[model samples]
Target: MCFSASASFVGSAGIALVGVATLMQVRTPRTLLFAAIPILFALHQLLEGIVWLGMDGRLTPPWPQLAGQLYVFYAQGLLPVVMPMAIWLLLPSGERRRIVPFLLLGASLSAYNLWFLATLPTDIGQCGHSITYHNPRTREMLVAIVYVIATCGALLASRRRWLVIMGLANLAGLTVVALFRTWAFTSVWCFYAALISIMVYWHFRRERMARHVEEAPQDHHFPAGNGP
Candidate 1:
């Protein structure tokens, strides 16, 4: 339940290692963005760790505020867009068209969130064992609905079975967090999303293996003992 600075930092470092390994499995430029998510998630957690330090009274004024802003900027202002875009780009050519609407929707939502987060006031407080971020616009039910369609819907739409599984996992994670800790939704969901990048690692690993099998060199040599 308790998330400390040390714990966040350690988690960040561990995920970063997995993220890098996932990135190494990428076989195409289109997949690079999707593969980079875990790395970005690592940085996101690192920012939260700084926020944790601030909450513990270890950071001076302004620093904590800056960290919190950056954290929210990504969680609220950016993820909806990036998640869909990542999926869109990673999709095979024929399938890319199917995801265009979700990409557009996510981009529009991201723009609204970016504008709101940039202009509005945001505050973070320790709610029980989690950090609760207060952003009025992000709290809107409509916005939450749109955000879900943008992120999870796109993932579910993918032809890739692994992506669909990832989508389901995230949906389950969101429901659990929303049910038990609505106030800490931002913190907990982002953390859960970070862990969900494990699916990304596996997805790419499996895809890479499949690609190798398909592309593996074949022996075209004729038999040495042909009929006279």
Candidate 2:
């Protein structure tokens, strides 16, 4: 999937449209973060396109380096925390307890990533037509385990059906990415997750439509207007 900049650009454009639509559907703050997922992914992909261009020597230096750094910053440093926190925001009070632990863990992981990203340089390279991003600090076995728990765990713990479904989808994708492209985990997995993010729109759209249906006025017929 990391074949070329064109793929990344085209994918980003499509995602941006879906992302905008999803944002338009948001009616409350609780859903705003979740709904913003698609657009965030769109931006992420767009950044990757710039990285691809830079990597391919079509773009100048510093720009590509900057793009790649930003990409890793979001995918590795910020995403884990956002995933669980977004899930937590969508869950009801009763359902929130299940998500809190992941939220805490994600926060920890994000903090760790931020520290490492600031202190260390993320090494980027090409592997099997994919971009590989590596931060020595984040590449530890324990960190990978915790990263999964923080992101996917919260989604799975969610009572919301769409979130649960998305969680399962992400888990399945994660397994494949883990098995096949471990070196490109950060890049490859994020690409898959970007596609998965479209469900964010679908979920919000379904929710908004359901709300509309519930709020729609119901007609009641009187028995031949007897009082009149």
Winning candidate number (TM-score): 2
Task: Tell me the lDDT of candidate 2.
Answer: 0.90
Residue-wise lDDT of candidate 1 within 1-228, one digit each (tens)?
137888889989989998999999987899899999999999999999989989999998788778889999999989998999999889888889878999999999999998988888887889877998988987888988898889898999996789999999999988898788888888999999999988899999998899899999998998689777
Worst 10 residues of 2 by lDDT: 219-228
Compose the digit string of candidate 2's lDDT tens values, residues 61-82. Answer: 9998998989989987899899
Candidate 2 — which residues are off by over 4 angstroms?
225-228
**Considering only N, C-alpha and C atoms within 3 Å, which residue pairs clash in candidate 1?**
none
Clashes per prediction? 0, 0
Candidate 2 clashing pairs?
Answer: none
> lDDT score, residue 17, model 1?
94
The CA lDDT of each predicted structure is 0.89, 0.90
